[model samples]
Target: MTSSARPRRRRRDRDRGTYSVETAVLAPVMISLLLLMVAFGRVVDAEGAVDAAARAAARAASLERDATSAESEAQSAAVRSLETEGVTCRTSSVVIDTGGYALDVGVDATVTATISCATPLSDIGLPGLPGSKTLTASWTSPIDTYRGRQ
Candidate 1:
């Protein structure tokens, strides 16, 4: 404690390597958290896109006058919606259910569109995760009771 002598170092001052040690301990955890967030975000985004596609396809199908046209329109709508989001589908499929066409006026019928998409995320290289994830979405639109049946 003499004026000429160096002051006694506090315990905190003695630890010059603490930052490196803390960084070494925290780097992997931080990196892992970041990667998990990215993957989760991708999945959420894909889900939203697929849901939108399903809704669009169902609406398009409901607007069609015939089963064939409905099917085609549904497929096109689903594909276009997904593509607009820049989500690549390894193998995408659209199925339209036309059972409601048989119902008569005053009865409700539904146009249903189911879209299944296989998106690859192998590039992320996360262990225990599948190379590809299948995302499926379905939507139903009610056909107008007065609409003509075909």
Candidate 2:
């Protein structure tokens, strides 16, 4: 090849490798960011589900006459809600307190999710990133004092 053609060919070859190198360097970062976003979204969604479950449970608890049934109802609601959101609940608990004519309900949920960084150059592994989050919600409603009064 002529000197001019040689230089042109060299430049083209250099550029040809640059794209792949750039992609290799940037792909991981891009994938990590995407995984982070997905993890954050999962946390938010789980929290929302927990809140919804807590509210439902609290409403049920407020109408109940004892704390045992209230806790049972709350746990059931939370588990069902978490399942619907595709998140596993590592632990869940509900506490109900009654004083005078007031009822207070507290619900806690520990949520977990798996996030995958699906990129050609990503270093994150197949088990994906494991994330855990906790959410708590509480509600207080006045108990009916005269419901069974004569």
Candidate 3:
């Protein structure tokens, strides 16, 4: 019994450091995976924010009666929406299609708004990840057919 126990103890002692070595090798991989998930989550969040901003801008513009004011309102609405969502864009742009304003009052018209934003991800410093991602979203809202338009 003593002889058998002696060999078992020696084997256990030899394998003691294996866990440390495995952990040493796998720790970075686990950390990298975690960072990758974070980066992905940020991108998804940015996309959702952009989508909402576009929707808000289009809705705001559709409420306006003139092309000039519609564009102005759309731009402000887009900016406000992004800010409200806590998304910090490196560069942001809003494009408003006010062609619907030119249509007759009784016609079915729609206002389109496109929101573009550059989201920064280089701060994460994850390998193989892009330094920045550009996200764009467009939304169209129908104007009230019976409403007056200039």
Candidate 4:
């Protein structure tokens, strides 16, 4: 019994630090994967926020009575929506298509709002990733058929 126990003790001693070695080898890989997941999640979140901003801009523009006011309101609405959603863009642009405002009163007309946002990813600490990604979203809302437009 003493002889058998001696060999088992020696084997256990040899394997004592193996767990630490394995952990050291795998920790970075695990952390890298975690970082990647977080980066992707941020990008998806930014896309959703951009889409919401576009929708808000289009809706605001569609509610206006004239093309000039529609364009101004769309820009303001997009900025406000982005701020409310906590999305910070390196550079942003809002484009409004107010041609629908010039259409005949009885015609089915729609206003389009396009929002482009350059979302910063440099803070994510992932190597080999781009510093920024540009995401664009567009939304169209119907103009009031009976409302006067110019």
Best by lDDT: 4
Residue-wise C-alpha lDDT for candidate 3, range 1-150, written one tens digit per residue:
999999999999999989999999999999999999999999999999999999999999999989999999999999999999999899989999999888887999999999999999999999889889999999999999999998
lDDT of 2 by residue, 1-150 (tens): 587899998888878878888999999888878877766666677667666665665565556556555556655665565567665555566554534223222332222111211112122332356544556666555445543211
Q: Clashes per prediction?
A: 0, 0, 0, 0
Give the per-residue Cα lDDT of candidate 4 at 89.
99
Q: Candidate 1 lDDT, tens digit per residue, 76-113?
A: 99989999988998898888997887788779889999
What lDDT does model 4 reach? Answer: 0.96
- Colliding residue pairs in candidate 3: none
State the lDDT of candidate 4 residue by residue for 24-73, as single tens digits: 99999899899999999999999999999999999999999999999999
Best by TM-score: 3
Instruction: Give Cα distance to truth, residue 145, candidate 4, Å.
Output: 0.8
Model 3 CA deviation exceeding 4 Å by range = none
- The residue pairs found clashing in candidate 1 are none
- Please state the error at residue 115 of candidate 1 in Å: 1.2
Q: Per-candidate TM vs. native? A: 0.85, 0.64, 0.95, 0.95
Q: Rate the local accuracy (lDDT) of all candidates.
A: 0.87, 0.53, 0.95, 0.96
Q: What is the C-alpha RMSD of each candidate to the true structure, in Å?
A: 2.5, 8.6, 1.1, 1.1
Candidate 3, which ten residues in sequence have the lowest lDDT sum? 98-107
Q: Give the CA lDDT, 0 to 100, for residue 19 in model 1.
A: 97
Which regions in candidate 4 have their CA more than 4 angstroms from the true location?
none
Q: In candidate 4, how many Å is residue 81 off?
A: 0.2
Best to worst by lDDT, what's the order? 4, 3, 1, 2
